[model samples]
Target: MTHSTDSNQTLFERAKALIPGGVNSPVRAFRAVGGTPRFIQRAQGAYMWDANGRRYIDYIGSWGPMILGHGHPAVLEAVQKAALEGFSFGAPTEREVELAEEIIRHVPSMEMIRLVSSGTEAGMSAIRLARGATGRAKIIKFNGCYHGHADSLLVKAGSGLATFGHATSAGVPPEVVQHTLVLEYNDVAQLEEAFALHGKDVACVIMEPIAGNMNFVRAGVPFMRRARELCTQHGALLVIDEVMTGFRVALGGAQSLYAQQIPGFRPDLTVLGKVIGGGMPLAAFGGPRAIMEQLAPLGPVYQAGTLSGNPVATACGLATLREIARPGFYEALAARTRALTDGLTGAAQAAGVDFCADSEGGMFGFFLLPRLPQNYPEVLTTDGARFNRLFHGLLDGGVYIAPALYEAGFVSAAHSAQDVADTVALAREVFGKL
Candidate 1:
């Protein structure tokens, strides 16, 4: 294969002149890997074609919405049919109600739900609802959990628990994040201490139950159980953000998994996105009737979007959900994902490389280390330079993974056993070179 600077270089150069960092999203620029981004022309069933017509196995899955894979026949048909009727009505629609009912039915924790246009909207609204219901101001969140760029949730860890959080981004005012407490993930002791000190004034504790942005580190079972207990004891709501793991992890989302692991455990509010939209721009937040009633025209706390429950988006989501509910959908999907991760792990081991990997359902991540990392700090201990080499090697071998090591990878139902085998073979070759 000849490496040419014609198409990709030309497109990137033109893009940089119009878009900041030559990409709509920062990480997509391949900044972490130090290369020109591959401009994708089309995607279908576990493969994507670049502008140069080069094909590669796609593992990003549009950051998790394409669980059934790009251009799924049913989803595409639903979206197309809905499009003929109309797009956004800004009024009530039967499809929206049906989609909401479907989600509430699967996620028992949600007694009522409100649609939103994006995960950030759902998360931000959930926080507002929590505050309105509790009549409290403070909220606690975990570090390294990317819950969107909401100002209040954008704070990094401060010097101490009692100290106010420092803004992680430039524009976010320090005062805005002062009441937002940032704590380390998997640190049960700190969680308890924070609750003990400020439990009275706290509105909620929001977290990504399974932190995917930090490469799929999960909240320790004990930590998760204890967090729920303390929130209830403190009169604070437990808000589970499942934007990435929602339907992708399980039919009912992360909360369902938690319920099985911890008896009598359920979040007060759950935020959902990704697979629910089926590659469209849609998201939602829901909870018990009493708490959810506090939002919008029902109560003082206000949240609304013009595109909320757009008919096409709802149709796509409904179709995707219905398909996943089919018999053996999850079983087959999980098996395929397991095959890919297991095969890669085995190949790396054979190549005499230190690799640790973990997966749940269709989402997975791996580290260039011997054991799985328990927290963000531990995850940072990975050899990033080595990872960059591996990433480029795999790309050159016609496989596409996440550009950054901190992001988790996805395996859609469209991926075949052959795709998994080929990916493992490529990884083996990459590991040998490393």
Candidate 2:
């Protein structure tokens, strides 16, 4: 129960001397919250143990891949069996075909699929395929819907709607981002204007159905329906980046939810990662036969990776898919997620704190504002200092959440009712202090 700061601080200092920012990922550095990052030694079920040997209920879920929680028995068994067979062959494997078939079965829109190593690679390749298929140069992306750190995608909104975005990263040249048009999330009017101006030149309109990076902002149903229409009318692909929402949202994904609301609703292409990998390094992109066939040996849009469709990763994914496919899996997960959100909302109300939250399936996000935000600029209006205090208080209470407020949190099947209750109790304590 006792946590020693020396162990974490010493490890962090040693890591900073060697690795950039003392972490492989920038967010793990805890720079936003101003604290020594916890050096996670191991994770099991819904709990993670830091290097200081303190346990905390984990809500990050390895950023949305651990839907069944860490080391689910079925997934572990499949991974172990596959590792015994081989790691990478660089040619092809039956497991890859099976994984592809499994994915295609769930996602009907994708007649074909290609596995990759990371979400960034999958997204980047999807954009290239979009460009090659349409023979166009421009792509439309929203400001807060992160489609990985791909150069064209890593862009901020330009001076005006008519102007394209500017590069947000240092190494990415301005020319690389000039073709990318960044729009506001859930803005149908701006979307219509952009399409009217450059419909002929746009290759694809890519977006996350629910923007996760800027917290959880659902792309308005009206906005999504209009986006599909605009893409169809302009001969541009409607690409949905489901890297974070794919299986985490539902059996069919966020697309399935949209389809229920909008008749015949579906994207031309879908880019996916996270839960599909089952905590391994794997991602995929696919669409209809004619379009997806545009990539690799079949077509001119060449893409290759030595580690693509890795044997062990595919096994892990296949196992995960099988487990989640069982009856009542998603229903149970959704109910548990609702419980957590409602509990937190109640706790905040009791403490007289302004709070709002939203969730879909097992994915959730909360804000200190009185109501949920709809776009990147609105999301930024949250008081960072106040959220940081809440972050530290949760950490102190042994309930782990994302270090930054902009990121969405995940709940796993491994999360017990007790864990949710304890988390709310902790939050209530913290809210009182706030």
Candidate 3:
């Protein structure tokens, strides 16, 4: 089948003229996949209609916010009701407090919380709070664990351990990242050595408990436990950036999952986004009272947002949370997700393809290799050309996943057994071709 470039091409051309790379985000440009970006018109349930009226079974789930699926009745109703009340007041609202309380009730680690407009703001604020509370300068982060696009967090490590990270993006001065330490994911030895060298100067160690940016790599239990121990021993805070995993991995987020594995394991600060906003631009950072009180109006550190605690966003988030908290919500979602992944892996094996797939709750990823990767460098060894071919093949077959292979795929509660089976059948056909 020859794919036609009609409306989507025209839209991309027009968008490129207006917006940089024809996208607000870099990955949306389809630079890695080499295709014209699809201009989505509308989405309902698990499907999206592109500019040309082409329909697809969306697996991205709006990059992880639409857990209850696109246009869920409850979420829409709450959003519509909130919209009728007002859009933004730039003042306090009762719903914001309610949302905060709901989050705190679910995630016990959050004793005090503050709302923000984006994940970047939440992550940046968490780092600042850590620095202020500890009076330390340096911070540690892991590779492939993206903490938004903050300047300090953008640094990539140099050749050796104990060396400072260099900025990965332009416009970030070298001096800004001098105190930023970037270590390898799942590398407990490196993590220990870094603390040994600069534990006293380190303010916090920020990481994604379950890294979805590098296609759903998880932090090893020992690595996480050691990180928590080292941070505690050094008087540095352990900040878990749950921007992607928050409310998606489980009811209480990745922190809850980690706590089960390592008893009494909770980060000093947690950064949240994605599902928490229910597709709106909302995020938050929270921790214990002692650390949270360092923020201004209560203490010394200063951080504020005009749109912080937005009412409509809060209403949407609250409704989504309530829906997810329903009995058997996660269990059903996980079962369906497992079915999909297992079917896909089995199909690939039957076709004599080298594939490794893993799923947790509603999120999953697969590599065109036999063994699952544990870190960014290992994940980079995936066959990009094969993935691009399979991606386009799946697009031709009516299933939509993230255009980039490095990003994880999501399944919503709306996905049925039929959706999983159909997706697996499509994958079988695609793998056969490969």
How high is each candidate's TM-score?
Answer: 0.96, 0.97, 0.96
Better of 1 and 2 by TM-score: 2
The Cα error of candidate 2 at residue 82, in Å, is 0.9
How well is each residue in 1-434 modelled by candidate 1, as lDDT tens digits?
Answer: 34465577889999999999898976586877778899998999999988777899999998999999999999999999999999877899999999999999899999999988898899999999999999999999987787776889766521111011233767888899889998899999999999989999999999887888778888888999999999999999999999999999888887888889999889999999989999999999999999988887989999989999999999999999998988888889989998988998999899899998888889998999999988767877888889999999999999999888888899999999999999998899999999
For model 2, what is the error of residue 325's alpha carbon versus the real structure, in angstroms, after optimal superposition?
A: 0.6
Worst 10 residues of 2 by lDDT: 157-166
Q: Tell me the number of clashing residue pairs for each predicted model.
A: 0, 0, 0
Tens digits of per-residue lDDT for model 3 on 239-357?
Answer: 99998889998999988988999999999999999899999999999999998999999999999999998989999999999999999999999899999989999999999999988
Q: Candidate 1 has which clashing residue pairs, if any? A: none
* 217-301 per-residue lDDT for model 2 (tens digits): 9998999999999999999999999999999999999999999999999999999999999999999999999999899799999
Reference-based TM-score, model 2: 0.97
| Distance from true location, Cα of 271 in model 3, Å | 0.5
The deviation in Å at residue 249 for candidate 3 is 0.8
Candidate 3: regions farther than 4 A off: 1-5, 157-167
Candidate order (lDDT): 2, 3, 1
